[model samples]
Target: MARHNPSAPPESVISIIAPGMQIVGDCQTEGTLRVEGSVEGSIFAGKAVVVGEAGRVIGDITTQDAVISGRVAGNLVIGSRLELQSTSVVEGEVHARRIQVEEGTLLNGSVHIGETDGSTLTHEGQSDSEEQQLPIDAGSWHRPVVAAPKR
Candidate 1:
């Protein structure tokens, strides 16, 4: 029998949860993990996570990158990128550095994207991220002419 050491990391690793399977506990991995069935617990991945169209997750997810085409009922915290396909249905908050959503995807909660590293762009000595009040010049806009109605 070969000995396995948990202290060292593998160069490349990929884990998969197949269809018709049910997992009821938290899962953590240092590499990519794919889910094709149902999970009732949280998931943590150092690399990426891919959820199939038939998959379902009922717990939170933390990962670097994720591609979801399934149903999620908890929060998602993605460090890099996140993609939601047309078949995906999400009902919880989502936080990701970057995100892509398909036209038919259904998201029922708040979504936060982009970096939040305290580096905000500034314009006119004000933070561009904040709302701006533009001064309206009366002569700058012209109203369209309408035809008069005949009595």
Candidate 2:
């Protein structure tokens, strides 16, 4: 698969949430995230986020890019791009630099697209590998994806 450009418009990041899994709580990260199950909280990503066809998010979202192919009920902040797939259904506010909606997608909320001031990017937590080693209900969160600081 081609690597997504973090600097690209928020609509460029490609992510997928496989069917069957469910997540509940706040999520923060960099690069890209795809949800195919159910997410019941907030999402904050430095790069981009994608909600799969079978996915559902019930909270706020902040990211540089975003794509919705499922259902979302919250606010969205996209610094660059936002795309809604044909299977997408969003019920919240959207803030982005660019927005695209495919035929058949449903949106019910406010939207703002442009550049803002003082926006810093960062990611935090542990790795999925580590989280997997622990018990299913251990209450550990995954780490964010961050680029190495310039030398």
Candidate 3:
């Protein structure tokens, strides 16, 4: 069943699963979620999902935004933005309108950025040459440093 937060606005909501907790069933919420524990099933949230350091998720996730600083081992679908912090680790497929991976983060799998419907969003770093060579092993992908064009 879907979980609703009555106090949350129609467009955004917030929920938290602190460290030490473990859930083994599907989670469906119409808001944001901050997880510091472990989940072994699918998660569906309307707004955003933050996975804290030390947290681990072993299932699919669907949300509008995601800020991960832990570990995820499943598919991820983000409608707006997906940010992977330096301490984050992900091993799965990703579909997002926008994606951000901080230096030192680890991701191992396929990634499809921008809207699948062919709409463009504000995106950086990803290139067509790179996209064609996706599903890159985490050991092979290197984050490039953009330098200012020399005059």
- TM-scores, one per candidate: 0.71, 0.65, 0.72
TM-score of 3: 0.72
Cα-based lDDT for every prediction: 0.71, 0.65, 0.72
Segments in model 2 whose C-alpha atoms lie over 4 Å from true places: 1-17, 117-151
Ranking by TM-score: 3, 1, 2
Q: Judge candidate 2 at residue 69 and give its lDDT.
A: 85
Q: Give candidate 1's total backbone clashes.
A: 0
Best by lDDT: 3
lDDT of 3 at 14: 64
lDDT of 1 by residue, 32-69 (tens): 77899888777887788899998888777778789999
Query: Compared with the true structure, what per-residue lDDT tens digits does model 2 show for residues 1-151?
Result: 2356667775455454467867777876545778878777777776778787888787776777778888777767677789999887776566677899898876665666665443543332221111211122112122221222334
Off by over 4 Å in 1: 1-11, 117-151
RMSD of each: 15.5, 13.2, 8.4
Q: List runs of model 3 lying over 4 Å from the truth.
A: 1-7, 118-151
Candidate with top TM-score is 3
